[model samples]
Target: MWKNEAEPSLLEILRKITELKLFPLPEYLSIITKRSNEEFEEDDSEDERDNLIDAWDEALKSSFKQLEKYADYISDNSSFGTHQGVKGLEFLRVMVILDDEEARGFLFSYEKLFGAKVLT
Candidate 1:
């Protein structure tokens, strides 16, 4: 869990994301976050890059094992899991996006559960 929120460099964050899910963010976001904006021409080194990616994958898997306790905390109906574990994961917090199942009677319960301002 700590590693997910660790202050790694930008590139390292992307690499950790790749480690979690082969390709983490949406295509557009990935392109924007990964592209390099440099003045000098850098050579491409396939071996080194591959090694780093592999290292990240191993590190992530290890971290996952350590934080195994909170795996089932999020309900299946929630959109927090497997979806955003890519880059930096934020646990203990979930976005209860409104849905049709949420009728007026359920508003107060949600408000109490999440301390959210439900205007119902």
Candidate 2:
């Protein structure tokens, strides 16, 4: 979903959460991607790859710090995670990202997941 057009909306939600001072400013907020940096790395020079890896490491560290900062609030609050990573966990608010074009199967279709009445 991150690669899709829904990224803007996702960023907007994060901005609103920060701007509105929601959930104690630092708590109940997290972002997880479906794939890691290594998985995303394509063809690149050694130096370029190293730089990219470093940047990804820094970002991961920052995310970890944010989670630690809000460790207390997370017990009953919400978190953003990929479906694969969130298995066996439950949240008060679970926002699933299902791209209309990407999720076309019977099980994934909007019509099946959310009936026609709800869609309208």
Candidate 3:
């Protein structure tokens, strides 16, 4: 879904999650946590109010799984940054160039090609 876009929004990612049914929303009425006060009392009933905290946890797990499952597709040798934009995906891969000279040559080549500006 993020193949061509510049940078997809969080809502767009969430929509993709639903479309893919990657992790899926919970099957219960999400709790609405609140600070109890003299005038305010906690009430539990049938309502799906996550207030983001719950939603955040769910989103992270889902997002991480998506990154991990699709790491190969999301990363490349030349450009670590995926144009498809896997938001919140960090440490996508670990690589050993295995040759200091090769690594230096690569940097010099990329600097000449891309003018020292790291591709984002």
Candidate 4:
């Protein structure tokens, strides 16, 4: 989908998330631990700014497995991946093909990188 359609779709997902009233990361993980009857270490730190904490705060608030499935869907369906969209993803190997002439967006340009175009 184009930017016009994608933005509204994402906003709708966020709205649904708010309506779900899902438990916070720690609380949800604790519940899972109890359900699985598995011993787990408790994090004593209360730092909210931690990266892992922030990731769980955004993506995994409702379910641990949802993000993987969502990422797979995006990988299979989307034509291009943005930096924000691919956050927290890991891959063993990646190959990028760049042709600045055909680039549709102005987010990045190889001309600047190669000293052919100077910044204003």
lDDT of 3 by residue, 33-65 (tens): 122223113333346755554454344333333
Model 4 stretches with alpha carbons more than 4 Å out: 1-89
Runs in model 2 deviating more than 4 A are: 1-8, 24-120
TM-score of 2: 0.20
Q: Please write out the lDDT profile of model 1 over residues 1-120, one tens digit for every residue.
A: 345665354445555586678666765445434545451124243445545544433443333322332333344543333442234346665554533344444323433233223334
Better of 2 and 4 by lDDT: 4
User: What lDDT tens digits, residue by residue, belong to model 2 across residues 49-75?
Assistant: 555444543444333224443443344
* Candidate of highest lDDT: 4
lDDT of each: 0.42, 0.40, 0.39, 0.43
Identify the superior model by lDDT, candidate 3 or candidate 4: 4
Q: Name the weakest run of 10 consecutive residues (lDDT summed) in model 4.
A: 32-41
Model 3 weakest 10-residue run by lDDT: 31-40
- Note the clash tally of each candidate: 0, 0, 0, 0
Q: List, residue by residue over 1-120, the lDDT tens digit for candidate 4.
A: 235543233223443444465543345433333332132123434645456544533443333233433455347653334453333457755554445787666776544432335645
Give the residue spans of candidate 3 off by over 4 A.
Answer: 27-120
The residue pairs in collision within model 1 are none
